[model samples]
Target: MTEGPPSILSLAWLLSLVYVFVAAVFVVRRLTDKSGKELARRIKAATRGRDAATDAAGDLVKRHEMSGLRWLDVFLSRQAWSRRMDKMLAQADIEAPLGIFVLLSLVLATTGYVAASLYAQNPFVRLAVGIGLGLLPFKWIAMRKARRMQEFERQLPEALELVGRALRAGHTFTSGMGMVVSEFAEPIRGEFQTTMEEINFGMGVAVALDNLMDRVDCPDLNFFVVSVKIQNETGGNLAEIVGNIAWLIRERLKLKGRIRVLSAEGRMAAWVLCLLPFFVCGAVQVLNPGYLNLLFTAPLGHILIYLVMGLMTMGILVIRKMVRIEV
Candidate 1:
């Protein structure tokens, strides 16, 4: 008969007000900044003699605002949202503003909270679930980004082989990359196409490659960077160096695939074991009602459950470590 702590509507209103205040301060500082003005001027200058796409790009950069919350930005840098956005953008071929993602994150958090609240039987349990849901998308995005990076790494040697052949045939790096865009398919082609444009717009090859590496964070790209850097420094046959690098990468990728195959069963077992307790508890509470109520209904039961969860989590990690082979 007791009322819930507060409706989700109330929580949303509080969050909305805080977001508005933060946004307003951000806007105010941006409006007063000479740095923003200088950057805008530079973009205008860069795109002045260019075509419609370049002009649109200039406008997009000028309008793309990321100000305030420097602390949060730094913290999230450790969390890797930029890397996630990069892969998502490349895959989806979406050119929408980054702010759209910020909004999407909030919406995702709310959906998490609502889903948790509906499934959880107790107010305290529901609150805990809601908080977890709120942070779920960030973790989800990180996992998605990692998977995409793995895929990209697996495909990189092939892309490099294509580029190496084109470069040896007397094509400039930019043109060679454009060849990649035309000849290859999604992900590699799309990412290279963007890099090609960035290079055309006055960005240096090294800088563009670094930017691309930042997006993927793949180990294969690290080797490619090393090859390029060495070629730039020592004046060797760049094509030969790239071809050798591609061979090494392909071997590494093959090894990684075999290791993954060997580890799959262990990883699945760890996942199931870790998840089983929570699912069983949830199902029991839903079906029998009183069966698992004692856990939350008593302090001792709550502490015992928490201890069990901690142990189970530790055990899962141990199994995960056993199966994880870093190549």
Candidate 2:
């Protein structure tokens, strides 16, 4: 039996919607794929080098391992984020920075607002919470990046010493770096390997070194770069200079570690103090919902809550700053 006209019309409408949905999915995938390819090209182009041929190709492959919305890259500086991003990117060898992260944050914020309006009993509060939650991923990414970079900085002197020994024993600077790249763990190995590869792709050694320092953006790395640059310019004993710098870095790392150990209790105390008030309020809400009804529903109560939140946020920042010991 032939289908009726209404059945045909309904089928046509359903097919149209399906086609539209499929088209959207394909377009999104195509765009993301194109963007990935472009980022890979940029990384390879920028990280070229001589003798080692270390391009961003390998690093780019590593970067794709992350969930793509790492919060750590947002709040941290390029120095910290680059190291963390490098780890994530290195896993997948992704050559791009965290541009996709920013996009994800905005999308999350939008999603939170929409979800809150549709499902939350109190839209404004839920929306605010959603935005805060959306910001959380970036913060996490930043912290991870900071910690990783700190670890790298702490170990940099040791790696430098290894390279210096190799250089003194008659290895070329490039070969010494290659040894470090192979022997040292990430992020030192990963970073040096990338630099070595870039240099191998025909970039000048000085420029490649500068690029590495730029990406690292650590004062420790900067010091090494300065020594290298000066040695190149004035014709000094490069290995000896690097060796001394390595010693200084080790001393600094030791001092910083001691300070961190001493300040551990204070840091822990600050975190607890900062979080206590929120914990109490959340408990009260759960135990006596009516007792806290005004906090969300009343205009005056909402304002007060915001004021309190602002103050709490400021207090946390102050405590964090007080506890932070810059080495």
Candidate 3:
């Protein structure tokens, strides 16, 4: 007797497993690959469009591609939103192509819809799951960007003090930044190294600093860049100025920490409030299996569920705004 062909569900599961394995491998390679080959490739691609005339003139400003595929790169280049996404990826230090993320999101959304259909018969529930899963990539990007910016801000004061010491030791400003590149760890080191490379490649100090500011969304970094630009114009005691800025940044960080500590209660309350409804719903389902069946089976129940969800979202936003004190 011959075996029957696999069911559609089995095929879907198999495909999902393969996709997950491939994505995991890709992520691991991206995280561990430190050969700088990718960076070199991007630099080469960026410079490929420049003429020798521009090269000779030392105008080596390169336009980076958003995707590996020529068509996708061209399409992304034309879209403002894609450019913003590219910048967000850069801020997060993610080296993956934008097209990969776009494709991944679509795949995830489709997978989510299929998975939801296995347990949920409502179209709205399936759509909601799909949208939620589709947003995971972007949400992850945002979280990564936030963590990186926080780390950068945390390192800025020490990096600045190091630069200040180098300046006082009679090194040029660029030399001070180079020292930072050599001495500091990731994020700070990478950023400074990029700025140094840009300067070496004929980009002006101010313009390079501006680019750095664009790449980092830290207000404290804005202060450093503005101070450097001002000092270059006015011929001040650069070392003293840097030291003062470092001190100011350190104090502000301390104050921000204290503010977070004080608002800890509010943050905790917001979290509990956000999670309570889901916990209750889950408990109700477990305690009495069909008690909440109407919510999934009836139109009126669906309307109520949506309204409750909308109100919960509004409450969460308001609570977040109340607790988030900008320092």
Candidate 4:
């Protein structure tokens, strides 16, 4: 007897297997690529001590590509949004190419769409799942960027104090920055190192500092950059200025810590409030599977669901805004 036509579930599984195979091949190719190794070597060499003037005078110009794939990179280069995405990736300190992230998002979206199709009969639910999955990559990048910025902020005061000490010990500003680069850990070290490299690569101190500020998302870093710019124009004891800024940052951080401690209960309550509905819904689904079937099946229930989701989203945003005190 011949086999019957494959079901949607079987088709989905077939597609998932194909996707996994393609992803594995891509990963293997990426791992074994010679160009990636060459780029790594170049980056390592660039970070080593070298004659800045000679390197700056070299005819070699570095190309900033958005993606590893040439065609995708070319396409992304023409799009303004791609540049913003690239900046976000840089801020997140992700070494992966933009193409990889875009591809991952597409794969996730496709997978989610297929998976949702197996269970969710509603087209809107399937589309929502796909869109939500597509957004995951960007959400991850945003979270990473936020975490990195927080770490950078935490490291800023110590780095500033170190630079101030270096200045007081008769070192030049660039040398002081180099000291911070060598002494500290990432992402502050990486940021300062990039600033130093830019300065060395024929960029002016003020321009380099401005670029640094643009790259980093920390507000405390702005104080350091502004102070440096002001000191550069009108001569003052730079060491003392840096020290004062460092002290101010430390005090602000201390106040922020205290505020966080005080607001801990509110934050916890916000989390509980946000999660309680989902927990109840999940528990009900487990205890009485078809009890809430109307919510998914009926038009009025769908409208109510959407309205409730919107309100919940607004509430979450408001709660986040309330808890987040800018120091």
Per TM-score, the best of the predicted structures is: 3
Model 2 C-alpha RMSD to native = 10.4
- Point out where model 4 deviates above 4 Å: 1-18, 21-63
Query: Each prediction's Cα RMSD?
Result: 6.7, 10.4, 5.6, 4.9
TM, every model: 0.68, 0.69, 0.83, 0.82
What is candidate 3's TM-score against the reference? 0.83
lDDT value, residue 246 of candidate 1: 93
- Residue 217's C-alpha lDDT in candidate 3? 88
Order by TM-score, highest first: 3, 4, 2, 1
lDDT (Cα, tens digit) per residue for candidate 4, span 22-102? 587477547644566656656666677465434633522345656656777789888998889989999999987677777
For residue 51, model 1's alpha carbon misses the true position, in angstroms, by 16
Ten consecutive residues with minimal summed lDDT in candidate 4? 53-62
Each prediction's whole-model lDDT (CA): 0.71, 0.72, 0.86, 0.86
After the best TM-score superposition of candidate 2, give how far the Cα of residue 210 lies from its true spot, in angstroms: 0.4
Ranking of all predicted structures according to lDDT, beginning with the best and ending with the worst: 4, 3, 2, 1
Tens-digit lDDT track of model 2 for 1-327: 954344557556655664565455445544545456757676667666532233455655555432333444334334665556555543333444454454456556765565455445676667796788678656766666677678688779888998899889999889989999888888788889888998897888889998787666468998898888888888988789889999999898889889888889888988788789879989998998789877767989979987987897888788788778897
Q: Which whole-number lDDT from 0 to 100 does residue 110 have in model 3?
A: 85
For residue 300, model 4's alpha carbon misses the true position, in angstroms, by 3.0
Question: Which residue ranges in model 1 land beyond 4 Å of their true spot?
Answer: 1-63, 66-124, 170-172, 278-289
Worst window of 10 by summed lDDT in candidate 2:
65-74
Residue-wise lDDT of candidate 1 within 1-327, one digit each (tens)?
966666779778766865775466557555544556656766766666567556656675544433234543344445566646645654444443333355445655565566566556666676666567656655665666667676677678888898899889998767778887888876677778878888897998788888887666677788888778667777888888889999999998889899999999999999889888879888988989888767776989978977997898799889978998899
